[model samples]
Target: MSTIEKALAKQKTKAPATNDVVTEEKNTESNESVSVNPAPAPTEKFDIFIDNEKLTERGFLHTGGNTTNQQEEFRHIKRKLINNAFGPASKTLNNSNLIMVSSANPNEGKTFVSINLALSIALEQDKTVLLIDADVLRPSIHRELEFENSTGLLDYLCGDTDDVSQIIYSTNLNNLKIMPAGKAHHLTNELLASDRMATLSKELSSRYPDRLVIFDCPPLLGVTETPVLASLVGQAAVVVEESKTKLETIKRATSSLNEDLAIGFVLNKTIKTSKDVYGYYGYGYGRKR
Candidate 1:
């Protein structure tokens, strides 16, 4: 063969090899473009605005309450409950972080204590608080907090919504969260006693070791669900109204609670004079054998 013919043939073969290399690079770029994904959207907040000024005016604890003696009183009260939940006492108790605040009868300030206690705990450096208004029959968390009522615990228990995140709401009060009692239902008491509620309780207690979950429950005397709920929590704070709560009634109410629970009696409305702080006085209770 001639030299020119040999050079042309060699050049033609090299051109095809170069084209094949360019084609392979183009294919790689196309696959990468198809695989690349867009960034995700930010999640919206499920939130509630707690009225701190109203809460403070009503003699409750919160950031707005400032350095009042009432704050000092609750600090003393929550200190023991904190010890029971996260301190040394937590070792011996099942789900010590789960606490229930209830009363012998209605209108005894259980909800007041529940909100204040939640506010008190939310102030902790390392702890968070979720307040669940479990009193479905007569929901008050919304009324007291001055927020419009909405679906929550009942909606979840009724299978209206399966997601727990949908029910729990963040508050403006920093580290404090809440789940309202939700719209009242006919089978409310039955729902509280269901196996699903039990499972939910297990998840709430076990999921967060640094979070304290408080349930503002119905009165023990008239309600059947309180005892079922009492069985779930490790601690109970029974509010007894000063002068109005009869001794025998207190006996009957306390008798219904589970013995294994670490119980505490909160003396409510102890204000003898206008000058007094007139806050709750909590005393520990132990079952008598």
Candidate 2:
């Protein structure tokens, strides 16, 4: 069996019987049947063509086929995040599983890092990943993954839908699921700070404590929603383009975040030189409180 097929078979074997699945009534006017503690259900899975050619052109990890140095870099980066999530370091944090990937400014490669990190984490034997497009103002996770656009975080927060399971999509990767940004809204910032959004965030972390929920948030400097979203996550990674991003910019971006959130810095697009052993790019863990 292929990797995807093997994953599907494993899911089927682990799934509870239909009658044993938990179901709850929708509190809203809509009568949708929502699963209270929806374990990764055996649902129809969609295929995402990682397209190594396209990914390499964009300077992303070529996860579609053969292993590359880029993939190895992310594996190393994810290991630290995973360690921080469940290791002894995580004992003090409440929602260490929720992570937000952001940048100092636009085009700093935060989205690329977010997707790559999610992909890397999904490869874990005992971990599943949920990549959320929290960059609602300019959503890109669905587009980057080449998945069809569907209702997502905003829809759940707007009261248009109460059942979040309806918007969450399972991918052929089995361990990776996606939550698109949903339709754009003028009051995006307000919606993100809503009570429902807070509830949803808590639900996502608590329902699947084993799952790593990664949010592709907007640039920290200019975006209003990013700071709000960052507050909800236990950890945040700020992607800084090597030589291009200014120290002042990084300072300004990081200042908006909560003092308690564990922050990390990822130096992306560094020039590859013969002197270095790891090719290009570097990462550093920021202050963790």
Candidate 3:
């Protein structure tokens, strides 16, 4: 069983700590008839087309998708940084649809941040969010959300599937959907840069004006894909590991982006205390250090 199904099954027996999947069956025993409720199987299963080869399996995105609390923390940072970076770029830019979560290199929490951001937006009572795993070369959102990777953005882009919506997996998060990346293609770069991607973006944006689309892209320095993706996303956020990201590397990454793309930096794994929350700088809380 997929992680979501497992979680749902657990939820059926108890309150889920995060997303809840509830199933109810009504039954009546009579001399001549019996009644019961039907349970629909949760979404599970996936496939991949690698170098013109096809493969299939259960979902991956929802498998280990981040929880709601982690999402909330990301939301806090996203809200704060948008005000700091994009606020002045364009008053209307705050109303952007595309958001790219990236970093100088790998292992800096970019994927975690991006997925959580999408989850955060989806959790919003008034918003609809779609988290697209655009990192085709090494896509992880599929695994995170316990989503089946059989057919997805790559499938749609390659014309393997005509109905793009078929691959969109509805999640426990209300109003939230996911479009994961499929197998690596021979022309991955061309597909990402194609007009088809732009058209898909436009349609998705137009359909859900209040929707937020978060693209979990590859590390800017490690792959050409990120800069290419940056060209498409309206804004980008960089997650810097505390005491690790070099200022020079950050500059190089930022320099590659178009100035029109709003850039914001977040210090992750930051050390803080209660005083820090009370207008006091540094790691101390209310107590003086």
TM-score of every prediction relative to native: 0.80, 0.79, 0.68
- Residue-level lDDT of model 3, residues 1-289, one tens digit each, is 4332343354344322345444422212211111122123344332221110111122111212223233334556656533433355435453356778788888877776676556445434456767788888889876654545777788878888766545566554445667788767988888888888777776665555556778888888867877777877676777777778897787877777766666666666554544222111111001111
User: Candidate 1 — which residues are off by over 4 angstroms?
Assistant: 1-45, 277-280
Clashes of each: 0, 0, 27
Residue runs of model 2 more than 4 Å from their true location after superposition = 1-59, 62-65, 273-279
After TM-score superposition, what is the CA distance of residue 86 in candidate 3 from its true location, in Å?
A: 11
Q: Is candidate 1 or candidate 3 better by lDDT?
A: 1
Overall lDDT per candidate, in order of appearance: 0.75, 0.74, 0.58
Q: What is the Cα-based lDDT of residue 94 in candidate 1?
A: 79
Ranked by TM-score, the better of candidates 2 and 3 is 2
Q: In lDDT terms, how accurate is model 1?
A: 0.75
Q: List the residue pairs that clash in candidate 1.
A: none
Q: After superposition, how far is residue 134 of candidate 2 from its true place, in Å?
A: 0.3
Point out the higher-scoring one by TM-score: 1 or 2: 1
lDDT, residue 110, model 3: 75
Model 2, span 204-236: residue lDDT tens:
777676788999998988779999998788888
